[model samples]
Target: MPLLWKTSILLAISHDSNILPAHLQPLPSRGGHIRWNWIGDEHLNKTTDIIYMNASVAADGTLTGVSDFRATKFNGVTWLKTHAGREGVFAFKGPKAFMSIPGIVLPQDLKTFTFEASYAPQGAQNAELIRSGDFRIAWKGDTLSIQNGANTYQGSIPAVPAGQWVQLGCVVKEGIPSLFVNGKAVALLPGQSQPLTSIGNATLIGSGYTGMMDELRVWKEARPATRLGRDISPTWADRLLYFHLPADTKRSMGEDKASWASQIAWIRSRLRNPADHMVRLGIAGGAWKDMLRDPKARQKFAGEIASIVNRYKLDGVDLDFEWIEGPYKGDPPARQWDNYADLAQRIRKAQPDMCFTISLHVVCYRMPKKGIDAVDYFTFQNYGPSSARYPFDDFTRSLAAFRKQGFPDSKIMLSVPFQGTGDAKADSVRLYSDIVAQHPNLPPTADTAEFTYPDGTKRKMTFNGPATIRKKCEYAKAQKLRGIMYWDMGGDVRTDARKGQTDYRHPKALLPVINEILKGRR
Candidate 1:
């Protein structure tokens, strides 16, 4: 009987070199050169001009990076079904396989830089984990080394165990670098501080290390050591890239995959109503405050946003502008508000067809009338605890206040809260979906949900159930308000629990309730 052997093999041959038969291979000649080639064509002409829409994009400035594999097909990385876990988390299994985030040119004027990701290694002792031009983070015999220009910083980190997840981070500030592992600082081999060379090539990950990575983030500001391992909030303004959630997998008008924009497209696809979707713009930090103070910066900012709106074929842009006045900026609150309105005017001038709107967070007196005129509509965020029922009196009073400020009833939108608050213990802020899943027999018209904790005590959470939602919609219609704006759709009893997935017609869902009341569809 003939001997049999079984194993898996990957083969690669040079296009310009000789091809050898599987059964026979030539031995290496003396002094012959050995070359390692990547699996994808490096010279492929691909455009990385497309912008990814994420929670960050909804609020912050323009960010350029690949949030999913679809954005990197130009560099030979395509979406594959074998990818496990949630969207945006990629699994790399081959040694020569790597993915590059295209069109990444490190801005030379950036004062600080930070890169971080959560990854699970797969026993590659010597492999490059991330590389961009001369900057590289690699593993050499279980030790991690970071290199930039002529400087190499090797940290005294423990042996990286193969199947466990580790949050790795590196921050470079004023030519000095710091390494963080799992939120703790690592002792580094000292070397002279040298400013990193600006990266002109694409940032590549998993060049040789076979692993799984998720929650990749990059920042133009070198985040302090305290915030190294903690997940950055979605609204952080300094963030250059935030690929943390499921919404990252899709584009604004991409026909290929699902995204926030795609979800809006999906809604319009099913409805006869000419619904328009606009990306929200706001920021959680001082970036916006500083930018608005300067006339030139504000103009450039508005133009960039208008360009994004045009490029993505979006309906328009919405301003969730908050934090206009703070002690950090000595300018009076009224002045900042004026600057904000001026920014709105600039944006409006750039794209006259854009449906400009704003989320009303300030008092009517502080809100600039000019800004109100520039916007097509405004959503009043009347947020408070609905201990047992929706605050009908407060809601009406807020609308009256806006009206006193010259806000038209037809241009005002009512805000609805889908998340539970007050009375519920342990998890006070529970999603409507979780509440519904806990009590199947609960009535959609009910205003409060009761839950029993492990301690045998029951607590009631007051949220806007279908009945409350319908009541608000009816009030909006009766008052001649523009429309109802749900605080968020993600917290509802979605047909699917994943982000960006919505089943608008679910009996207990708030959306269908609003539709029934406002659209007369019941």
Candidate 2:
């Protein structure tokens, strides 16, 4: 699961019957064998068609798919288990080894589309990574090539380094085809006029590619070049198929079996008033300091940010400068606090109509007041030890620290963690969903849950349960704060099933608790 922050969760209803329901939206893509299960009478029939973005495999060797379609392994394509906390990767034993999937239909127009995957080559060789109908995505030695009828090209994409996990994507938007490697657009080919689909559209993955392929996805729409290849867990909405080629290994992030994009689309389609809810894109990166340090680049970058905000019709932008106190990579400027402030000011100037907010740790008290005043609100990262070791004390002390630093009370949003802190020497934070799934009868007020492993090692996870989350919401309301904030919607206990799968909203979920405390039940 990818980490996203939100100040609030609001609902709306869509009235139009003409719109295709979100779950019914076509996703002709491919990935691992994990399934995304949906709960609710309205979704029972649509669940079979849901498109999942995250990928995970079943450990029992049985291909368990939530969708009606299935993946068939052919010619010695085997599973390779990796170290604990990582998904089990697929191993292509020889040239003939591959995985075949039926029912992946590319758009008839083929004017725009995207095909992408993650692969680690055992050695350099000409290999076909994806083949279906007349479309062929292959690697001619280190160069990625595509052969779709006569509209074909080779070496347009930069040479892919051998023996490393590289994410490769081909995005054909508006008749022009571009190649993206590791999130950056590397090459482009002449436009094609023919349909990209074939009559018999079964997809074969990894014939002649003697390597591991994972996190595969195909989409009818060309993914935004600026947005592709950035996050491993991009939402699956218009995609045809999505698969993660490995099994869970007790990691903090759960499987990407559910169609988050479809769920959101369905929710949005049913909204009574769209203005009641909003979606903000979070922006953060180390390279941002350099862009902001120079005046010319800063203005241009700010404009680009605004373009994204306006073009997508996003409600706002959230600034998450993680390296505010940095001599990043031991570069010059030991503290880039001023640069961070400048960035906020620049983006604010560019996109004044859109809401602007920033997320900061307690160490950011020293950030210039100029930067502090540029945004609409401030979200304090109040759940961790550097803020305070004790739970309730941490919240209060962290707020006081920011208050002392002069952040306005009305613009302050208190933070809550749906995932547990690593009190049990856990390698990663434990999701609230996993905690409740493992301990269904655990007390709602109990903020800590301990588990014993097979080796008799005991570890305790500290997190906010329904009771704790409610208390925090109430506290924020009492303090007259702007609102409460949480790291993600994915971490809350959203399903009733105990298999630790699916993405449906359960009654005991944390968001509902927050809603009850903050807004009163509808």
Per-residue alpha-carbon lDDT of model 2 for 360-391, expressed as tens digits? 77665456788878877676665552213327
Put down candidate 1 lDDT per residue, 1-522, tens digits, no spaces. 111100000011001011100000000110000001100111000000111123222123432221222235322223323234445545666566676655342334333687777776667556667676667777666577887667777876776677677888888787567888888888778544346555465666666666666656555567777776573332223234322222234342112131234333332343232221122322222366667678887787677767767765665545545644454368887888888889878888888886566656524335678877887766566543435324666677777788887887756766666567655442455556667777777786776767654467667767767776667667766776666555443455655432223344466765446445554543
**lDDT score of residue 264 within candidate 1:** 30
TM-score of each: 0.62, 0.53
- Candidate 1: residue 128 Cα off by (Å): 3.2
For model 1, the local distance difference test gives 0.51
**lDDT of all the models against the reference?**
0.51, 0.54
Ten residues in a row with the worst lDDT in model 1? 21-30
- Best candidate according to TM-score: 1
